[model samples]
Target chain A: MRKVSSASKNADRVFRVATGVAASSPVVFLVVIALIVLVQAIPSMKFNGWHFIYGIQWNMGNLYGALEHKNGVTAAAGASYAALPFIVGTLASSIIAILIAIPISMFTALILAYRVRGVLQWILSILVELLAGIPSVVIGLWGIITLAPWVRDNLAVWLSHLGPVVPYLRGPVGTGLGLLSSGLVLAIMIVPIITATTRDLLMQVPILYREGGIGLGMTTWEVVRYICMPFIRDGFVGALALGWGRAMGETMAVLMVSGSAMNLLPHNLYSPISTMAAVIADQLDSALTDASQMAVHALAELALILMVLTLLTNFLARWLVTRTGRRRSTKAGVAA
Target chain B: MGKSISVTDLKAWYGDSLTLKGITMELDANRATAIIGPSGCGKSTFIRCLNRLHETSPGAKMEGSIRLEDEDLYTMDPVDVRRVVGMVFQKANPFPTMSIYDNIAIGLRLGGIRNRTELTDRVEKSLKMAALWDEVADRIHTPATALSGGQQQRLCIARALAVEPEVLLMDEPASALDPVSTLRVEELVEQLKESYTIVIVTHNMQQAARVADKTAFFLNGELIEFGETTGIFTNPVDKRTEDYITGRFG
Candidate 1:
C-alpha cells in the first residue's frame, strides 16, 4: 500500500465529512421540525391534557381560564376542542381512497407495463405522469364544481335505498360534498403515483422470468398473476403505503370536497367530515386572532399528531419492507 | 411421446433486421439435435422460433412453417404450441418467487392438474429425471433461487419436464456452469434423449459433439450445414462448418 500525502489525506477527510453532513441533513430537519411542534404544543397539553386527542368535541372558547367570571363581569362561554372527529375523518377517507385506488392503479400499471406497446404506450405513460404533476388545488376545484353534484344526484340516491338496512347509509344525503366525494377525489389524485411506481416495479422484473413462464405454456396474465406480482409484492405494499401517506396529509382537496363539518363520526359515505389538516387550514387565521392563545396551541398539537402519524406510517412501511427483504435474502442464501 | 419437428423455410425477423433467414431442418423424435454457431449467428433465435418464443419480442415476426409431428405450429395457439414444446433458457430461471417443489409443480398446475397427490408425484418424478432430486429432496420447500447455478438450471429442466412436453429446447444450458456441472448436464441430456426430442443451441463445439445426435451449423442467420454428428465433425460438408468445428473462426 502507498502512503497518502498530507494534502490528499486532508482532502479525503473533508470529502467524507461533507458527504456525512449531506446524508444527515434530512434527519436533522425532521428532528428540528418535531421539536418546534412539541414546544408549541406544550401549552395545549397543559390545559386540555390527553383529552385534546381522544375527546370528540371541537368548541373554540375552552382554553385555560378564558371563560372564568370575575369582578362582576360575565365571561364568554367556554369551547371544547376534542380532536377525535378530525382523526376519524382522516383515517376513514384515506382508507376509502386506498380501497378504490389500488385495484384500478394495479390494473392500469399492468396494462402499461406489459400489454401496451409502441406510440400508444408512450402516450399512456405520459398521461399518467401528467396526472401526477397536476396541482392538488386544481383537482380540488374540479371535484367541488363537477364531481360533488354528480355523486349527490347519482350515488347518494342509490345509497339511500339501503338506508334502512345499513345504519351508515341512513343519514340524509346532502349535495355530495362529503366523505365519499373526498375519498373519490383522493383516489383520483393518488392513482398516478401508485400506477407509476407499480409500473416501474413490474417492468423491473427480469425478462428471463417472463420467458420461463411463456416457455411453460402460461398465458401472459397467468405469468403476471403468479410470477411478476409475487416477485414485487413488497414493492407493491410500499407503493400503497406511500399513497396512504399522501392521502392522509391531503388538505386542500379534502377541505373543499369533504364539506368541512365537525362530525364526530361519519354516519354514511355521503356524510360531511373534517380532517386534522383541513381543520388547521380552515381555522388557523381565526385561532390566531382569538384573545386566548389556546386555539393556536391546540392547532400546534394537531400538527404534532399529524407529524407523528406520518412518522409512524413510514416506520411501519419500512419495517414491512425490511422484514420481507430479510426473508427473501435468507431463502436465497439457503438455495445458493 | 417425443414428436418429430420439420421446419420449412423458417425466416425470423426483429423489426426490419433479419435474424434467422430461410433455415430449414428436420429434428427426429427421441434424439438430441445440437445447433452450433458463432455469436449473433441466430443459433438461439432459430430454436426460439420453433416454440414461437421468438415472436414474443416486440416487432418480432416469423414467416414460413414449423410442423410438430402432424400439427402446423403456426396455426395452433401459441400457448398450446408452447405447452407441447418446452424450452430451457441459457441462464437458469426457476421462478425466484417459488420453492423448489412449487417451481416444478407450477407448470402442471397451470395445465389444470388440481389433484394435490398427483402434483407432488409429478414434481418428484421430474426432479428425479433431471437428476436433481437427491440433492434438493430435503429442502424442496426452499426457494428455487437458493440452489446453485447448475442446480437451478437442472430445476428449470425439471420444471419444463413436469409439463410433459413432447419436445424440449435448450439454449446453451451448461455454458454458465462449472466443468463438473457441465458434464452432469451433458449426461442428463443423453438420458433425456431416450424419451424427448431435444434441440440444443450451443457455442461450445465440444458440447455439441458430446451430446448431439445430429449437428446443425448456422452462420450469418443462415444454415451452413447440418448432418449426422459424427459425419459433420469428422468430414467437412461445407468450409464454414469445418472452420467453425475446427475452431478456425468461431
Candidate 2:
C-alpha cells in the first residue's frame, strides 16, 4: 500500500494511460461507427415525417405530383417507407431462431458440462469455441450452396411420403431459399454461440447445489432439473438473448437464403423474405428514386429497433441475475 | 420412534483410494453418537454413507453394509435410505430459492404428501422440533435464504425432521455458525435425540462429551476406538484415541 517514488509513479501513470486507451479503443471505434450510421439515417427520415414510418404502397414514378403532394406528400414519394415487412422478417426470423436454438444449445451445454468431462468434453468445447471464428460470409456461402437445394428436394420427398397427414410440408416445395431455409441456417449458426455461452453459465453452477440435491435422493436428471437449471436460469437466458440478438441482425447469411422477396403477412414457410439488414444491403445501392431512398432509410430505422430490443433482452436477463444472486451476505438483511 | 443403526465392515473408497477403513459401530436408539477425527480422515464420509449421500462426489465408492433394524441401508435403495435417514451438512445449505415454509415442506412433498392441512401441520411441527417455529412462524413465506447463518442451519435441521426420518446424520453442523448458533444447534441435537437417532461428526472434542452418549474416534480412515463418551474422552484404551482427545495429534 505504500506510495512509490516519483519516477516510478510517472512510469505507472504512463503505463496506465497506455493500457486504458488500448482496452477502450475497440469500444470507442464501435460507438463512432454506430453514431455515424445514426447520423446518416436521421435527416432523410425527418423529411418524410409520420408517413415515412407508414404507407405501404411504394413506386418511383410518383415523385412530384403537385396536386397529390400539396404539403409535399407526393405520389413519387408514394408510400416510400413501410417498415412492416422488415419488422416482420426480423421478428419472425429471430423468434424462429430462438425457439430452435435455445433448447438445442441448452441440452448441448448441459451434456458438455456435466455428462462428458474428459478430453471429449474439451474437444467438443473447442469445436464450439471455433464456431465464433467462422466469418459470416462463409456461413452465407455455405447456406446458399448446400442448404437451399437440400431443403427443396427433402421437403418435396418428405411431403409426398406424408401426403394425407401434412399438407404444409408440400406447399414449401422447391423454393429452398426462403424463410424456412434462412431460419435453419440461422439456427445452425446461432447454436454454437448459444451452446458455448450456456456451457460457461452451466459451469458456473456451484458444486454444493448439485451435492445438496443428490443428497436429498434426487436422481441425476432431477438434480439438474430442480437445482442446476433453476440456479443458472438467468445466465442461460442471457446466452439465448446473445444468440437471438446476433441472429436477428445477421445480414449476409439471411440475405443469401431469404430469396430477397418482400410482401405482406408472410405466412408461408416457402415464401421468400427480406430482413432489415438484407434490405439495406441489397436496396441501398439502387435507391435512385426518392421513394426508394426513403424505403432503404426505413430499413436503417428497423436496425435501430432491433438494437433496442436486443438491449432490452440483455438488460432484463442482467436484472434477473442480480435479483437471484444467492449468497451468504444476502442473509443479513433478514432474521428468518 | 428412532431405530438402532448397525454398521458392519463399512469401507469407503474414493476411486480406489481407501477413505473409511472397516468402520463397525452400533448407534443406540434415541441417543446421539459423535464421530470425531481430523479433516480428511473419513468421519464426514462415514456419516454421509448412512444416508447414501457419499455418492455426491464424482469418484466416491462404497463397500459396506449398514442396516436400520434389519433393513440393509447400502442395498435397500438410496431414496428409501434418504427417507429413513436425513443429513445436515457442515455448511448450512438451505435451498435459496425456497421460502421458510417451503423449505420445511420440501421433504413432505418429496415423500408425496399433497394435502394442504397435512403439509401445514408437518411444516409447523418440524420448525418447532428444530426450535425455529417462534422465530420464523410469521415470515414462513419469506425466502429461507433471508435467514441468518444460524437460522439457515436450523432451517436445514427442520427440513430433515419434516420427513420424520428415523436417524439423523449431522456433519459438523455448527462449523460455519456463530457461537450462539452453535449452542442452539447443540441444544437442538440433544432435544432431537428423544425421537431421532443422531450421528454427528464434530471437530470440537468438548462438544462430543457434552451431547454424545457414545463417541467414536477415527484416524487416517481407520476406526481407532469407540465406547461410552466418558471412556472415549477420559479413559481411552487406544493410545491413538488418547492422543487425538488430549490434543497430542490431530
Candidate 3:
C-alpha cells in the first residue's frame, strides 16, 4: 500500500464539494421559488377560500366593485376565481398530447434504432434533432395559421356529421382554435423529444438480447417487440414523462391555438379551451396594470399550483424510473 | 432428426474486411465438433455463418456454399435456417423480462404453437434435457434473471432446446462460467450430442478434449487441421496443429 498525497486528497475533497453543491443547487432554487409563490398566493387563498379551486365559474366583471365592498361580496360572486376550466384544459390537452405522441414516437424510434442504417439513419436523426431545436413560438405561429385551419375544415367537419348523438361534437367548430388544435400542436412539439430519448434507450439495449431473439428465428420486428421493447420499458415511460412535463408547461404554443376562452368544460376535442399556462401568460400584463390585487394574487396561486404539479410529475417519474431500475439490478444481482 | 453440415470454400466478411477465409469442413450428424482457435481467428464467425446469424450484421457478406445435409443453406430463408440451426452464445442471454417458463416457451410461441398444454410440456421437457428442471421447477413463473449465472446459461440452453432444432451451434458457452459450472455445461453438451449435430467454438482445449468427438483447429481465418478428436491431439497432420496441441503457441 502507498501513502496518499495531501495535495491529491485536498483536490479530491474540492471535487466532491463542488459536485455536491452543483447537485443540490436545483433543489435550493426550487424551494426558493416555491416559497415566493406560496407567500404571494396567500392573499387570494384567504379571499377566495376553497371556491378558487372547486368552483367552475370564472366571471371577473364585479371584481373591481367587489374590491371596494370587500366585506360583503362572497369569493365566487366578486372575482369568480374558480380554476376548474384551466385545470380541465391543462389536463385534457396534456393527456391528449401524450396519447397522440406516444405511438408515433415509439414507431419512429424503432425504425431509427433497428430498421434504418447508414446515411438514412443519420439523416433521420438530424431531422429529429432539428425538430426539437425549433423555437416554440414559431411552432405556435405555424399551428395557428396552418394546422388549426386544416383541422377545422377537415377533421372537425367529419366529426360534426356524427350529429346530435355525440353531443360533444355537435358544437360549432370555431376556426379550430381549441383543445384539439392545442393538443395537436403539443403532440408535434414533443414528438422529437420522445422519439430521440426512446431511440437512445432502445439503442442502449445489449446486443446479446438481439442475438438471442435472432437465434430463435425471430424477425427484426419480433426481436424488437419481444426483446428490445420490454428491456427498455422503463426508459419508454421516462420519455413519456419527459414529454408530459413539457406539454403541461408549454405556454406560447397552447396560448396561441387554445382560443383562451373561459369554458369550464370542453364540449368536444374541437371546443375552445384555456389552460393554466395560457391564462397566466395572457392575463399577467393586464393583472399587473389594473388596480385588482385579487386577480394578481389569483394568478400567483395558479402559478403555485402549476409549480406543485410540475414537481409532483417529476417526482412520480423519478420514483417510477428507480422502481424499475431497482428491479433490474436485483435481477442482475440474483444472476450474479 | 439431426442434420449434417458441409461447408465448401466458405468466406465471410464484415463490411470490406474478410474474417473467415475459404474454410472447408464436413460436420457429422448427431456428433459434437469442437472448433479451437486463438482470439481473432474467426472460429466464432464460422459457426455463426452456419445459422446465417453472421449476415445480420450491417454490410456483412458471405461467399461459397453451406449445405445442411443436401439443402443449400444460402437458398433457404435465413429465418428458416436459423430455426433449423439454434445457437448458444458465449454469454448467457435469457430474455430478462420473461419468466423462466416463458423464456423456454418463446421459441415455441414464435413457431406458432399456441396450445397451453403443448407449450408447458415442451418447456418442462427442454428444462429437463438441459438438466435445469429440478433447480427451476419451483420458480418457473419467476423472472429468468432470478436464477444464478450457471442456471441462466442452462435456461438459455433450455430455450434453444424448446425449439427442437436439428443442429446447435455453441460459441464458448462455458467460458464465462466458474469451473464447476463449466464442467456441468460440458457434460450437458455430451448428452445433447445424442440428439443434435453440434458445432462448438472454444478457447479451452481441455473442454474440446472432454466434449468433442472431432476437433477443427483454426488459425488466421484458415483451418490448420481437422480430424477425430483423439487423433488430432495425439497424431497431428500439420506442424501448426502439433504446436497448438503441444501448447507451444495458439
- Candidate 2, B1-250: lDDT as tens digits: 8999999999998888999888888899999999998999999999888888887666788887899998988677787788778888887887766688977776687679999999999999989999999998899988778788899989888888888889998999888888899999999999999999999999999998999999999999998898999988879999888888899888
| Chain A TM-score compared with the true chain A, each model in order | 0.86, 0.78, 0.85
In Å, residue A68's CA in model 2 sits off its true spot by 11
Tell how far residue B243 is off in model 3, in angstroms: 1.8
TM-score of each: 0.92, 0.86, 0.91
Across A1-336, the per-residue lDDT of candidate 1 in tens digits comes to 998999999999999999999999999998998899999887777767788888987777643444643233322247556788888898889989999999999999999999899899999999999999889899999999999998899888887889889877765888799999999999998899999999999999989988999999999899999889988888898899889999999999899999998736787889889888999999898787656666787889998888788778778877877776525532332122
Question: DockQ for model 1?
Answer: 0.48
lDDT of 3 by residue, B1-250 (tens): 6899999999999999999889999999999999998898999999989999998888889998999999999999999999999999888999988889989888999899999999999999999999999998888988888788888888889899889999999999998888888888999999999999999999999999999999999998999899999999889889999898788986
What tens digits encode model 1's per-residue C-alpha lDDT throughout B1-250?
Answer: 7999999999999999999889888999999999998999999989999899999999999999999989999999999999999999998888888899999988999889999999999999999999999999999998788789889989999999999999999999988888888898999999999999999999898999999999999999999999999999999689888888888897
Superposition error at B103 for model 2 (Å): 2.0
Query: Candidate 3 overall Cα lDDT vs. reference?
Result: 0.88
Local distance difference test, each candidate = 0.88, 0.78, 0.88
Rank list by lDDT: 1, 3, 2
lDDT of 2 at B134: 92
* TM-score-best of 2 and 3: 3
Writing each residue's lDDT as its tens digit, candidate 3 over A1-336 gives 898999999999999999999999999998898898899888778777788787777655454454433533333234557788898899899988999999999999999998899999999999999999999999999998999999899988887888578776775876799998999999998999999999999999988889999998998888988988888988788889899989999999999999888845787878889999999999888777546566777888988888778779878877877775525543542243
Question: What's the CA error at residue A139 for candidate 2, in Å?
Answer: 3.0
